[model samples]
Target: MSHQLSDISHQTSDTRYQPSGVRNDAAPIGVFDSGYGGLTVLKELVKVLPQYDYLYLGDNGRAPYGNRSFETVYEYTLQCVQWFFEQGCSLVILACNTASAKALRSIQQNDLPRIAPDKRVLGVIRPTTEVIGEYSENGEIGILATKGTVNSGSYPIEIHKFFPEARVYQEACPMWVPIVENNEIDTPGADFFIKKNLHALFHKGPKVDAVLLACTHYPLLKDKIQEHLPIDVKLVSQGELVANSLADYLRRHPEMEQRCSKNGRQQFFTTDATEDFDNHGTLFFGAPVSSTHIVL
Candidate 1:
């Protein structure tokens, strides 16, 4: 399920745009996701870095990338990334976990150098993995994510790279995203799925003291998840972690920071019906969202 470099290089034609040439009209930082889940991350980014403008694109038309193959996810992600570049974005964040797991590396390694060497793209997994071990008392980390993310084994692999003694266990919650997207957080079905997945995760790794809600969409079900979680276990979400990481990143890379526009503006776009995106997006974003439609 892997694609060759030639397969995706054609999509990055506009990646060479220089920031200096467009400094007068600097573009907002791009935040992309498969659907509404990314709005959660965007919300935190706005809170921590309120001075900068941001553009968010959700590929709701071809979403639920959780079950898709690596090749398909990479292609869709690259296409969206290219769209961000065309919009004058010099930096893009793959806010979706499935995209981060399935496509981020290939896009960074193979496509960026040939197409947008000057541009930068980042993911949620690396930032979360870098600090995930510190939260665990015994280095027992449990991950609750989508099938694609779990199947990729990115968390365990990346965690091991940072914390060698850490024990990582994962449970794929395929039904959780659908439940959240459909606004079923309070329903019995939501509790059923949440308890089921948490049970599965703990059964395999009882020592898991900290559980990482690896999927952005999972935050909406936080209260319910905690209700069913063990009293002593810690629950970790990515929004704050990613926000802090981004702040540190900007501080470390002033060149990238200077390129980011700072009028405090925010725009939302979706590759699906705006009505649908706005309706569900508000719940994740914690505010009213007025979105426009865009064809990918």
Candidate 2:
């Protein structure tokens, strides 16, 4: 169920240029997600990179990519990324786990350079795993994510590459996002699923010192998850760590960092109508979105 790429270092920049899907000259860093899950990552970005402009696209109409076919997810993600590029975004973030699993590399390899030379397309996976490697005391960690992310085995693979001795256990709470999306965080069923999954992770016998909320949507349920977990263990949210990672990356690559602006713009778009995306996204974004529906 997993495709392993041994030596991803070799997967780095290949000289051969191919046609990129789109191009643009916008000031915003475009962010795409299947739904509101990306807001967690975006919130962190705004906190860390407050002076920079941003453009967010949430694909709410065709959300919950976790249960969809891989090919479908890839195509849908590609469409959004292309749309962002057309909007003049220089960099894009694949903030959804399913998209990162199914489409990130193809965009990086076959699509990005052609679209915009050396332009960046960041993902939530590697930055998260890198943070996990940094904080894991005994090298035992747990990952709570969607079924697609768990199936991808991205956390384990990335962790093992850096910390071979680390023991990683993952639990796919397929219903968690729906519960969170529906604002059922306090519902009995929500608590039941949270308890059930936490117990399952406990039974895995990993002595988990840190738990990574691999899916960005998981941050919406952070309080509930923390309440269910033993206090000794720490919970890592993708948004927080990803924000720090992005700051570091910007420091290292000055060209990619946005120049200081007196007034930065934050643009939002959705493949679905603004009404649909706004209704659901506000909960995660902590504010109403000013999204325009695009033909992606």
Candidate 3:
């Protein structure tokens, strides 16, 4: 049988569902990442919108979506997003760069209407691109992301839309994910990869005034990235920017805002076992995520 938001709402109506940090009236916002990377986005969400409820789904079993075909990534992301909707999520956020590049549009256009009229889906790329244009001093900016994201040219496209004069340079750090997953963020080889990417960007031109960390996992290597940057180059991260954007978006869309519960809390799920998810997720979220597991 297919599940619906009404099913979850009716079950909780009789009982007081206490919202901890976020809005209490609406269902939780669904967040999806290929693996633990989305934790970077989650951390900011909890910090900036603490009053909203959140449901996080990490597709750990079939992660590294950066290498997958567009069709495969789209299908996989759609499945996860649909599952979140069934679990009573009024909004879904694609915290993965790869998914945002490959699947966000198709899901928003086709899947959201089928789930709920008020339902919405968001992605990380546009938010980052939008923010970069506002903050960049010069018309030039740099982006360090996964191979898929760079290949998609999402950053440059969004940047051009906002700042026609902007010059966007992209460099893909394909190995950073594995290093972060292994907790080797500060290892020598990690430094080498970080420096290599930074060099590639700087070599493009001195006009690059800001650098956006296009991958969620890139934040884990922020310090190393900073070390290799020019003193004038500003670093833009998606987590905080995306969180703030959501807050602004909600405020402007009162209908969506009013549906959100001010007393909501964060709930986590993983395609793999909860134990493994908790361990690795803790490393990513910077705190223990004691939540249930749901296999995808």
- Model 2 lDDT at residue 57: 87
The local lDDT score (0 to 100) that residue 84 gets in candidate 3 is 82
Q: Which model, 1 or 2, shows the larger TM-score?
A: 1
Off by over 4 Å in 2: 1-26, 258-262
Q: Point to the candidate with the largest TM-score.
A: 1
**Estimated TM-score for each candidate:** 0.92, 0.87, 0.89
Candidate 3, residues 195-243, lDDT tens digits: the string is: 8878887888668888989999989889888888888889888999999
Could you list the CA RMSD of all candidates, in the order they appear? 8.3, 9.7, 6.0
Would you give me the overall lDDT of model 1? 0.88
Error of 2 at 243 (Å): 0.8
**Residue pairs of candidate 1 with colliding backbone atoms:** none
Superior candidate under lDDT, 1 versus 3: 1
Tens digit of per-residue lDDT, candidate 1, span 1-296: 21101133232222232223235646789999999999999889988876667899999999989999999999999999999999989999999999999999999999999999999999999999999999999999999999999999999999999999999999999999999888888999999989899999999999999999999999999999999988999999999999899988977776787688765667899999999998898888887788889997
Model 2 local distance difference test score: 0.76
Better of 1 and 2 by lDDT: 1
